[model samples]
Target: MRVSGEKLDDQQIIEKIMRSLSARFDYNVVAIEERNDIFTLTFEGLMSSLCSHEQQMNKRINSTKLEQALQSKASIGGHGG
Candidate 1:
Protein backbone atom coordinates (compact mmCIF):
# COMPACT_ATOMS: atom_id res chain seq x y z
CA MET A 1 0.00 0.00 0.00
CA ARG A 2 1.16 3.46 -0.87
CA VAL A 3 0.07 6.76 0.60
CA SER A 4 0.80 9.68 -1.63
CA GLY A 5 0.25 13.42 -1.55
CA GLU A 6 -3.33 13.65 -0.43
CA LYS A 7 -5.53 14.08 2.61
CA LEU A 8 -4.27 11.03 4.44
CA ASP A 9 -5.39 9.82 7.84
CA ASP A 10 -2.68 10.06 10.45
CA GLN A 11 -3.76 7.51 13.05
CA GLN A 12 -4.46 4.82 10.50
CA ILE A 13 -1.19 5.36 8.73
CA ILE A 14 0.70 5.28 12.01
CA GLU A 15 -0.89 2.00 13.00
CA LYS A 16 -0.35 0.50 9.58
CA ILE A 17 3.31 1.43 9.45
CA MET A 18 3.87 0.30 13.01
CA ARG A 19 2.33 -3.07 12.29
CA SER A 20 4.28 -3.46 9.06
CA LEU A 21 7.59 -2.75 10.79
CA SER A 22 6.81 -4.95 13.75
CA ALA A 23 6.06 -7.85 11.47
CA ARG A 24 9.14 -7.23 9.42
CA PHE A 25 11.39 -7.24 12.50
CA ASP A 26 9.53 -10.08 14.22
CA TYR A 27 9.02 -8.02 17.36
CA ASN A 28 5.89 -6.94 19.15
CA VAL A 29 6.27 -3.21 19.50
CA VAL A 30 3.45 -1.62 21.40
CA ALA A 31 2.17 1.70 20.19
CA ILE A 32 1.94 3.73 23.36
CA GLU A 33 0.36 6.67 21.69
CA GLU A 34 -0.19 8.15 18.26
CA ARG A 35 0.45 11.87 18.51
CA ASN A 36 0.39 14.11 15.46
CA ASP A 37 0.70 11.07 13.21
CA ILE A 38 3.81 9.85 15.06
CA PHE A 39 3.59 6.59 16.91
CA THR A 40 5.61 6.16 20.08
CA LEU A 41 6.68 2.56 19.67
CA THR A 42 7.91 0.84 22.80
CA PHE A 43 8.51 -2.50 24.46
CA GLU A 44 8.40 -3.77 28.05
CA GLY A 45 12.08 -3.81 29.03
CA LEU A 46 15.06 -1.77 30.14
CA MET A 47 15.25 1.69 28.65
CA SER A 48 18.95 1.61 27.92
CA SER A 49 18.84 -1.76 26.22
CA LEU A 50 15.75 -0.86 24.30
CA CYS A 51 17.23 2.38 23.07
CA SER A 52 20.44 0.66 22.05
CA HIS A 53 18.62 -2.11 20.25
CA GLU A 54 16.45 0.33 18.40
CA GLN A 55 19.48 2.34 17.35
CA GLN A 56 21.31 -0.76 16.18
CA MET A 57 18.36 -1.97 14.16
CA ASN A 58 17.90 1.44 12.59
CA LYS A 59 21.59 1.69 11.78
CA ARG A 60 21.71 -1.72 10.20
CA ILE A 61 18.65 -1.07 8.10
CA ASN A 62 20.04 2.26 6.97
CA SER A 63 23.37 0.70 6.07
CA THR A 64 21.78 -2.08 4.11
CA LYS A 65 19.53 0.32 2.28
CA LEU A 66 22.45 2.54 1.45
CA GLU A 67 24.51 -0.34 0.16
CA GLN A 68 21.68 -1.63 -1.98
CA ALA A 69 20.96 1.81 -3.33
CA LEU A 70 24.63 2.33 -4.16
CA GLN A 71 24.64 -0.97 -6.03
CA SER A 72 21.60 0.14 -8.02
CA LYS A 73 19.33 -2.22 -6.12
CA ALA A 74 15.90 -1.89 -4.52
CA SER A 75 15.11 0.15 -1.43
CA ILE A 76 12.03 1.39 0.34
CA GLY A 77 12.88 4.97 1.19
CA GLY A 78 16.44 5.45 0.16
CA HIS A 79 16.11 7.18 -3.19
CA GLY A 80 13.78 9.64 -4.91
CA GLY A 81 14.27 8.42 -8.41
Candidate 2:
Protein backbone atom coordinates (compact mmCIF):
# COMPACT_ATOMS: atom_id res chain seq x y z
CA MET A 1 0.00 0.00 0.00
CA ARG A 2 1.19 3.49 -0.78
CA VAL A 3 1.38 6.22 1.81
CA SER A 4 0.07 9.71 0.97
CA GLY A 5 0.06 8.85 -2.73
CA GLU A 6 3.80 8.21 -2.83
CA LYS A 7 5.64 5.00 -3.61
CA LEU A 8 7.58 3.42 -0.79
CA ASP A 9 11.34 3.17 -1.05
CA ASP A 10 13.30 -0.06 -0.91
CA GLN A 11 14.17 0.36 2.75
CA GLN A 12 10.60 1.31 3.63
CA ILE A 13 9.31 -1.81 1.94
CA ILE A 14 11.88 -3.97 3.70
CA GLU A 15 10.98 -2.45 7.06
CA LYS A 16 7.30 -3.14 6.48
CA ILE A 17 8.01 -6.77 5.70
CA MET A 18 10.23 -7.08 8.73
CA ARG A 19 7.46 -5.66 10.89
CA SER A 20 5.09 -8.44 9.77
CA LEU A 21 7.74 -11.12 10.38
CA SER A 22 8.46 -9.64 13.80
CA ALA A 23 11.88 -8.81 15.14
CA ARG A 24 11.76 -11.79 17.50
CA PHE A 25 11.97 -14.08 14.49
CA ASP A 26 15.56 -15.06 13.67
CA TYR A 27 15.75 -13.66 10.17
CA ASN A 28 17.88 -11.30 8.15
CA VAL A 29 17.31 -9.40 4.96
CA VAL A 30 19.77 -11.00 2.59
CA ALA A 31 18.96 -9.13 -0.60
CA ILE A 32 16.32 -6.99 -2.28
CA GLU A 33 15.46 -6.65 -5.94
CA GLU A 34 13.05 -4.37 -7.75
CA ARG A 35 11.48 -5.21 -11.06
CA ASN A 36 8.55 -3.64 -12.88
CA ASP A 37 7.33 -1.80 -9.78
CA ILE A 38 7.46 -4.97 -7.73
CA PHE A 39 9.91 -5.31 -4.86
CA THR A 40 11.16 -8.73 -3.91
CA LEU A 41 12.71 -9.21 -0.51
CA THR A 42 14.99 -12.12 0.19
CA PHE A 43 15.42 -13.18 3.78
CA GLU A 44 17.07 -16.00 5.65
CA GLY A 45 15.63 -17.24 8.89
CA LEU A 46 15.33 -20.34 10.99
CA MET A 47 13.06 -23.03 9.64
CA SER A 48 11.16 -22.98 12.91
CA SER A 49 10.27 -19.35 12.36
CA LEU A 50 8.79 -20.12 8.96
CA CYS A 51 6.85 -23.03 10.33
CA SER A 52 5.55 -20.99 13.23
CA HIS A 53 4.35 -18.22 10.96
CA GLU A 54 2.66 -20.67 8.65
CA GLN A 55 0.86 -22.33 11.53
CA GLN A 56 -0.34 -19.01 12.91
CA MET A 57 -1.64 -17.93 9.52
CA ASN A 58 -3.45 -21.22 9.04
CA LYS A 59 -5.10 -20.92 12.42
CA ARG A 60 -6.26 -17.37 11.69
CA ILE A 61 -7.73 -18.39 8.32
CA ASN A 62 -9.51 -21.40 9.75
CA SER A 63 -10.89 -19.46 12.68
CA THR A 64 -12.15 -16.71 10.38
CA LYS A 65 -13.93 -19.21 8.14
CA LEU A 66 -15.49 -20.93 11.12
CA GLU A 67 -16.72 -17.65 12.53
CA GLN A 68 -18.26 -16.65 9.22
CA ALA A 69 -19.93 -20.02 8.85
CA LEU A 70 -21.42 -19.77 12.33
CA GLN A 71 -22.70 -16.29 11.63
CA SER A 72 -24.30 -17.41 8.41
CA LYS A 73 -25.88 -20.42 10.10
CA ALA A 74 -27.33 -18.29 12.87
CA SER A 75 -28.72 -15.83 10.37
CA ILE A 76 -30.57 -18.61 8.60
CA GLY A 77 -31.50 -21.04 11.40
CA GLY A 78 -29.83 -22.54 14.42
CA HIS A 79 -30.03 -26.12 13.26
CA GLY A 80 -27.62 -28.90 12.40
CA GLY A 81 -26.38 -28.91 8.84
Candidate 3:
Protein backbone atom coordinates (compact mmCIF):
# COMPACT_ATOMS: atom_id res chain seq x y z
CA MET A 1 0.00 0.00 0.00
CA ARG A 2 1.05 3.57 -0.68
CA VAL A 3 0.32 6.48 1.63
CA SER A 4 1.31 10.06 1.11
CA GLY A 5 0.49 13.28 2.90
CA GLU A 6 2.29 16.51 3.58
CA LYS A 7 2.10 16.09 7.32
CA LEU A 8 2.61 12.39 7.59
CA ASP A 9 5.98 10.75 7.93
CA ASP A 10 6.94 7.13 7.39
CA GLN A 11 6.10 6.11 10.93
CA GLN A 12 2.73 7.85 10.89
CA ILE A 13 1.82 6.23 7.62
CA ILE A 14 2.64 2.79 8.93
CA GLU A 15 0.73 3.41 12.12
CA LYS A 16 -2.35 4.58 10.27
CA ILE A 17 -2.34 1.56 8.03
CA MET A 18 -1.94 -0.81 10.94
CA ARG A 19 -4.69 0.91 12.86
CA SER A 20 -7.06 0.71 9.93
CA LEU A 21 -6.44 -3.00 9.42
CA SER A 22 -6.72 -3.88 13.07
CA ALA A 23 -9.93 -1.93 13.40
CA ARG A 24 -11.62 -4.15 10.85
CA PHE A 25 -9.82 -7.50 11.05
CA ASP A 26 -8.60 -9.77 13.75
CA TYR A 27 -5.14 -10.25 12.37
CA ASN A 28 -1.57 -9.95 13.33
CA VAL A 29 1.15 -8.43 11.25
CA VAL A 30 3.58 -11.16 10.33
CA ALA A 31 5.89 -9.00 8.32
CA ILE A 32 6.19 -5.47 7.04
CA GLU A 33 8.59 -3.71 4.73
CA GLU A 34 8.82 -0.29 3.22
CA ARG A 35 10.84 0.98 0.31
CA ASN A 36 10.46 3.99 -1.93
CA ASP A 37 7.42 5.09 0.07
CA ILE A 38 5.52 1.90 -0.66
CA PHE A 39 4.59 -0.46 2.13
CA THR A 40 4.17 -4.20 1.99
CA LEU A 41 2.34 -5.73 4.90
CA THR A 42 1.79 -9.39 5.55
CA PHE A 43 -0.75 -10.48 8.08
CA GLU A 44 -2.19 -13.75 9.30
CA GLY A 45 -5.77 -14.33 10.27
CA LEU A 46 -8.52 -16.89 10.33
CA MET A 47 -9.47 -18.39 7.01
CA SER A 48 -13.07 -18.08 6.00
CA SER A 49 -14.75 -19.55 3.00
CA LEU A 50 -17.04 -17.00 1.39
CA CYS A 51 -19.44 -19.63 0.25
CA SER A 52 -22.51 -17.76 1.46
CA HIS A 53 -23.75 -14.62 -0.19
CA GLU A 54 -23.76 -12.69 3.06
CA GLN A 55 -20.15 -13.57 3.70
CA GLN A 56 -19.10 -12.33 0.29
CA MET A 57 -21.08 -9.15 0.68
CA ASN A 58 -19.57 -8.47 4.06
CA LYS A 59 -16.11 -8.92 2.64
CA ARG A 60 -16.79 -6.46 -0.12
CA ILE A 61 -18.22 -3.90 2.28
CA ASN A 62 -15.29 -4.22 4.62
CA SER A 63 -12.83 -3.82 1.76
CA THR A 64 -14.60 -0.71 0.56
CA LYS A 65 -14.56 0.79 4.04
CA LEU A 66 -10.86 0.13 4.36
CA GLU A 67 -10.10 1.71 1.06
CA GLN A 68 -12.13 4.76 1.91
CA ALA A 69 -10.45 5.14 5.26
CA LEU A 70 -7.03 4.98 3.67
CA GLN A 71 -7.93 7.46 1.00
CA SER A 72 -9.40 9.88 3.51
CA LYS A 73 -6.28 9.69 5.60
CA ALA A 74 -4.04 10.26 2.63
CA SER A 75 -5.94 13.32 1.56
CA ILE A 76 -5.60 15.06 4.89
CA GLY A 77 -3.05 17.78 4.62
CA GLY A 78 -2.12 17.82 8.29
CA HIS A 79 -2.74 16.16 11.61
CA GLY A 80 -3.84 19.45 13.20
CA GLY A 81 -1.15 19.20 15.78
Specify the highest-TM-score model's number: 2
Candidate 3, 1-79: lDDT as tens digits? 4444367655665556555654334223232332322243222211221124347668899999999999888778456
Model 2: per-residue lDDT, tens digit, 1-81? 676687976657556665566553433323222232224433333334456666887799999999999999897885665
Worst 10 residues of 3 by lDDT: 42-51
Cα-based TM-score, every candidate: 0.36, 0.42, 0.33
Cand. 3 TM to true fold: 0.33
Kindly list the per-residue Cα lDDT of model 1 for residues 16-64, writing each as its tens digit. Answer: 5456654533342433332322333323222343466689889999999
- Select the stronger candidate by lDDT from 1 and 2: 2
Query: After superposition, which runs of candidate 3 have C-alpha atoms over 4 Å from their true positions?
Result: 1-51, 77-81
Ranking by lDDT: 2, 1, 3
Candidate achieving higher TM-score, 1 or 2: 2
- Top candidate on lDDT is 2
Q: Give candidate 1 misplaced runs (Cα > 4 Å).
A: 1-45, 73-81
Shift of residue 42 alpha carbon in model 2, Å: 15
Error (Å) of candidate 3 at residue 11 is 58
